[model samples]
Structures are given as structure tokens and as C-alpha cells.
Target: MDAVLTNFANGDILAITWRPLLAGLAQTMLLSLLVIPLGAIAGLLIAALFVVSAGLARVLLMVWIDFFRAFPPLVLLIYLYFGAPLLGYEISAYAAIAVSFTLNTSSYFAEIFRAGIEGVPRGQWHAARATGMSWLQSFFVIVLPQGTRAVLPDLLSNIITITQLTALASVVSVPELLHTAQLAQATSYNVTPIIAAAVIYLALLWPLVRLMSHLDARRYSTKLSAAATQRRRRQETADE
Candidate 1:
């Protein structure tokens, strides 16, 4: 472990695989940019379906969410990469990766959105309706604003998850960071450089995680302060 850690920081190991590693990093970022929004939108729709509908729609949506969430992303990757070629639609490893990540991301995003939407106070919806807003208007005007803030931290956290998950692309022969590291290791028989790759992942994700946490804390504090001020003003008005 010490040797791996030492080799990782030595800077010599990185020189050999820099090209592939950089390419992998680009692929990973591109994949994330494509998937995150797609997943968020799909998740929002599913959350809305669960929220607004009744009976069969709700059941079906729940089942759909469950099914996808249960599906391992690697299996999905294989199916998309291998199975699609059989259907006469040949996809590159990069395209297959984007699709698999998007689908997998959609499942988790749906749940995060559902939780955030559910967290909204019931009184908010009722108040919006009292103001003559339709359900859609109320959702856009009231529910979404609050719900989005509530979910921002979770959503960003999922981005971090997606970054780590991109490593799985190695199995599909996508030249992501891990895949490149593996190739270099295979050739060099040096585990040190692979350690460097692992450090790169950690270095990339740690700051993201920290930033998200900081934002969450700041937002929560602001909300609490605002609520407290509102409550105090109401009490003063009532006393007067």
C-alpha cells in the first residue's frame, strides 16, 4: 500500500499514460454532460407521474423505477454494446457508454426527484391552488422552486457517483481513465501508475463532494434563517 501510494505521488508514473488518461477524462466528462440532464428530465417526469396520477399509473411508474434501479449498469452496458450490433445498429464504445450511463442515471435521478418532490410541504400545493394556479402552474411556480433547492445537493452528489461509475466503462473497452491505466499496467507491469490513476479519481471527486456539502450547508442555513425571521415577524404582527 505504501509503495502504491509512494509511486502514485512520484509523478514519474503519469508520463507514460498521459495521453490515454486525458482522452479517458474527456470521454468521461462528455458522457456526464450528455447523461445528467437526460436523466434529470426523465426522473422529473417519473416523479411527476408518481405524484400527480393515481392507481395504475402510480403502480406502473413505481415498477418501472424499481426495475431500472435494480438493473446493474454493467449489464446494461453489455446489452447496449453487444446487443445493439445484432439489431443492425452498431454503436461505438463511447456511444454505448453514454446510453448506459444515461439510463442508469435516469433511474437514480428519478428516485432523488421523487424524494425531493415528496419532501415539499403539502400546504404549499394547497396555498398555490388557493391563489388560482393550476396544478402545472403551481408545480412550476411553487413546488419546483422549493423542490429543486432541496434536491440540488442530492443531484450534485449523484454527479459524483456518475464520475466514479464511469470507471465501469473499462469493462466495455472504453478507454476511460481506469482502462488506460490498465493498459499501461499491462505493458509496464508497474502497479505504481495505476495508483496514480486512482489518485486522479480521488483528486477529481473529493473537491466536488466537498463543494456540494458546502453548498448544501450554506443553503440550509439561509433557509433556516429566513424561516426564523418570518416567524418572528408574524409573532410581532400578531402582538401588535
Candidate 2:
């Protein structure tokens, strides 16, 4: 019992490592902020291309998404950080992380956005066009909003996934949360810093998980209500 406390829950080690851990947390948050928006915007552009493209162009987009999505993000990061210099191109750790995460997470976000855009009713597009809206205007004003709303829960879930994935940034010694914890652990010869990092991660992500759950439930309930309304309308038409 005493050994467990000394090894995993020691107050002294926590005190020693708190500053590094906090700095690491800040770095993690910054990384998340940069990559999340980059990935989302890039993915949105990719998805928009998917909507307007077909034949060879669409095939190329598919290849791009599939290749990146299939590739391991860690290897991608390592390659960009280490192998780039070998090829005469210097890249910082943060830049490597940004590029790697954007590639990986953009593929994921592209797929999500594609799904959401497809889920929007075709009638909405037709209606918008009938009102003299250009294709781009209709897509942006009418379809995009509904599509995004329809998949808001999924988007939030993906954002949560991306946030967690920021931990992988530590692999290149970016000194994000997990990397800082590992360094502290090595120096202190104790597991408490690692445990503390875990607790911090849980603290950061647990609320997002709960919020995703709530959004998902609300989405489900809304779908059920819409279905019920449609059934009632059909029954009334039959009676009439």
C-alpha cells in the first residue's frame, strides 16, 4: 500500500513536476487549437471539392483521402520531422506535428463532412436553386448549414478524437503533456507524474465525452419525433 502511494501518488513528485506538466498542457491546448481548425477547414474544402467534382478529379481526391487515412500518423510525423532533414528540407517539431495532424485529421474530417453534406435533402438544393441562388450560394447558405447541423454530434465527436490525438505530438519531443510527463517520470524515477498526466487528460476530455453523448441523444430524439410526425401526417391524409 505504502509502495503504491510512494510510486504513483507521491505528493513530492507532483510538486516537482507540476510546472512542466502545466507548460505541457498549454502546449497541448495550443497544438489542438491549431490543428483542429486547420483540419476542419482543409477538410471542408476537400469535401466541397468532392461535391463539385467527378470522374478523374474525384478519383484523385479519393486517393488522397484514402492514402492519408490509411497511413499511420506517428510514422507520418516521424517521417516529416526526421526524414525531411535527410532530404535537405528542415522542419521544426511543431511544424511536423501540424502537417502530420492536418493530413490525418483532415482525412477524417473530410469523410464526416462528406457524410453530412450527402445527408442534406436534395429537395433543399432544388428549392434554393429555384429561388435564383447560384450553386455555391445555395450550398453555402442552405445545404451546408442543415448538413452541418445534422451532423453536429459527429463533428463534436471527431473534435474530441482530434484533441486526444494531440498527445501523439509528444512522440517528436514537442514537450506536450505526455512528453513532459515522461520526462518528469525519468527524472523523478517515479510513476506519479505519468499518473498525474492521465488525470489531467481525463479532466480535459471527460466533459467533451459527456457533451457528445448529450448531443447524440438529442439528435436521436429529434429524428424519432420527425418520424412520428411523418407517420401521423400520412395517417391523416389516408383518413381525408
Candidate 3:
């Protein structure tokens, strides 16, 4: 342990050893950027399906949601990356990793968004409908604004999960952060690079967590203020 600590402190982590590390970082960033938007769109669609469907469609949607929620991302990656090729359509390692992570991210984000949508009081939805707004308009303009604020924290946490999940790409040779660290350990026979890699992951994820917290706080405070104003107006009207 001391030897590993010493190597890290000495800055013995040079560019040659950093190649895989940088590659892994790149893949992590790429996967995050690609999947986040797709996940948001998928989440919205899934939420809508759950909201609007009745009977069997709702049951089927629940089953699909439960299946993805139960499935581990790594297992899904391995299946898509290694096993899918055996079935006919051969995808490269990077593509496999991207698709699997996107789908996984989508499933979880869908649930987060669904919960957010459900958080809005049913009265609010009825009020918007009473004002002649279509259900779609109410969802996009009012419900989603509120839901985005509600779900931002959970969704940001999922970003960290996806960042860690990218490491599974290493198993398929996509050469993400963990794999890079392992390679560095193999070459130097020292654990320092691996330790540094863990620190780097924390560094990358911490800012996102902090930012999401800040946003959630601001939004929640705003909502509370608006509610207070509305309550004051109601009290004044009753007195008049």
C-alpha cells in the first residue's frame, strides 16, 4: 500500500501509461453525452405510455419496466457485446457498450420521470384541462417543468451510475477507466495508477452531484414561494 502511495505521489504516472486512462475517460464522456439525451426522451415516452395506457398495455409496460430495472447493466453489456454477435447482428465493442448503457439509463430515467410526473397533484392536471389546455400541453408546459425539478437529483445520481457503468466496457475491450488502471497496474506492477483512477472518477462525479443539488434546492425554494403567494391570495379573497 505504501509503495502504491509513493508511486502516485511521485507523479510516476506518465503519458505512455496514461494512454489507456485517457481513452477510458473519453469513452466515459462519450457514453454519458450520448445516453443522457436519449434517456430523457425514452423516459418521457415511457412515462406517457404508463400514464395513457389502460389494461394490458399498462401491464406490459410495467413488466418491461420491471425487467429492465431488475437487469444489471454489466450483464446486459456482456450479453449485447458478446452474445448478440452469435445471434447474427455483429456490433463492435464500443457500439455494444453505448447501446446497453443507453437502454439501461433510459429504463431508470423513465421511472424517475414517472415518479416526478406522479408527484404533481391531480388537481393541477385538472386545472390545466379546465383552462382548455390539452393534456400534452399541460404535460409539456406545466407538469414537465415541475417534474424536471423533481427528478433532477435522481437523474444526476444516475449519471454517476452510468459513469461507473462505462467501466464494464473494459470487459469487452472498450478500454474504459478501470481497464486502463488495470493495464497501468500490470505494466508498473504498482497499484498507484489504479488508486489515481478511483480519485479521478470521484473528481469527475463530484461536481455533477453538487450542481444537481444546487439546482434542486433553487427549484424547490421557488415552488415554495409560489405556493405561499397563492395561499396568501386565497386568504385575502376569502376575507373580502
Candidate 4:
């Protein structure tokens, strides 16, 4: 342990490594924050189009989503950075990472939202139509609200996923945490900065992970009680 501590303390960690690491950490956090809502907005927009009948746009969107989700993010970053130049559109590394993360994250979010919207009880849709509401009106007014609530916990979890994925931005020279850590490691010739990066990531993600757990627990509790009440009510009706 003494040897380990001595090795860890070898370099001027605070003076040299911390600044760059913090800067990288800040960049990663900002990128994650920006990506989550942007991705969600993109996802929600695609999901809204689910109301339409089958068409070229819908088919194409599904294919795009499948393509990105199936494509590895790191590889996507590489392709976006290099492939775009070949197509006569040379984007910066930051823009490439942003576009890649957004599209990748949006694909998953889109599927979740579509499932949420579709999973909404069919009876409600029928009832809304019976009440003279147009299908679109019923979808936006009735189904969407419930669907969003049902998927809220999962959406938060996906945001956590995107946060982790920001580490992959290093591939495209995004100067994020891992990249910063690598630079520090290279300069200092000590592994402490890498450890620091891990701690920083843990500190950043742990709270959000706990919150997701709490949400899952609360959701399960609510579902269980609702089910129990439903069963009791049916029993009472049958008994009477």
C-alpha cells in the first residue's frame, strides 16, 4: 500500500493533471447534457410520426434507426469523421461526435417512445374516438401523456447510458474525460490520472444511477398496488 501510494503520488498531480482532467470532465458533462435533450427531441419527433400510416418516410426512418443502433458508436464516429470528407462535407471533430451521439441516442429513444405510445391501452384510443375526438387529437391529448409517464424512468436510464457513452467521444478527438486522462497519463508516466478519471466518472454517474433505481422501485410499488387493488375489486364484484 505504501509503494502503491508512493507511485500514485509520483507526479505533480494537482498542478498538472487536475486542470486538464477537469476541463475534459466539464466538456463531457456539457456534451452529455446537450445530447440528452437534443436526442430526446429528435426521438419524440420521430415517435410522433408513428401516428401516420405506412409510407416511404416511415420506412426510411425505421431503417435509419436500425442502421445506427446496429452500428457501433465508435465506428460511427470514425465513419462520420472520415466518410463525410469523401462525400464533400468535411465536418469538425466536435461536430462529428455531436452528430453521431445524437443520431445514435435518438434511435434508441425513438424505439422506446414508439413502444410506449403503442403500448398505451387500445381501449383508451377506441373510447377517445367514440367521444368524437379525432385520432390525432386522441393521440396527442390522451395517449401521449400517459405514454410519456410510463416511459419516464426508462428514459432517465437511457440518459445515464448516453452519459457513459460520452467517453467514446475520445475516438474523434473530442477532448473529453478519457482523452484528457490519456494525455495526463502520457505526460506524467503515472497511472494516477486514470484512476482519477474513474473516480470522477463514478462521482458523476452514481447519483443518477441511484435516482434511476429509486424511480424503478417507486414504479414497481405503484404497479403492484394497482394490481392488488384491481384483483380485490374484481373479487368483491364477483362475491357480491
Encode model 2's per-residue lDDT on 173-240: one tens digit a residue.
88899999999999999999999999999999999999989989999899889999999999899788
RMSD of each: 3.2, 2.5, 3.2, 3.2
Best by lDDT: 2
Q: For residues 62-180, what per-residue lDDT tens digits would candidate 4 score against the true structure?
A: 89889978988888889989999999998998788788888899988998888889889999999999999997899889998998887878888899999999999887778899999
Model 1 lDDT-worst window of ten: 4-13
Ranking by TM-score: 2, 4, 3, 1
Q: How well is each residue in 16-127 modelled by candidate 3, as lDDT tens digits? A: 5666777777777886777777776886899888988899999998888888878988899989988987999899987787677777788888899889998988888999
Model 2: ten consecutive residues of lowest lDDT: 166-175
- Residue 153, candidate 2: Cα error in Å is 2.0
lDDT for 216 in candidate 2 is 92
- Which residue segments of model 3 deviate by more than 4 Å? 1-4, 7-10, 212-240
Flag regions of model 4 displaced more than 4 Å.
Answer: 9-11, 55-59, 126-137, 227-240
Off by over 4 Å in 2: 227-240
TM-score of 3: 0.84
Clashing pairs in 3: none
Q: What lDDT is reached at residue 7 by model 4?
A: 55
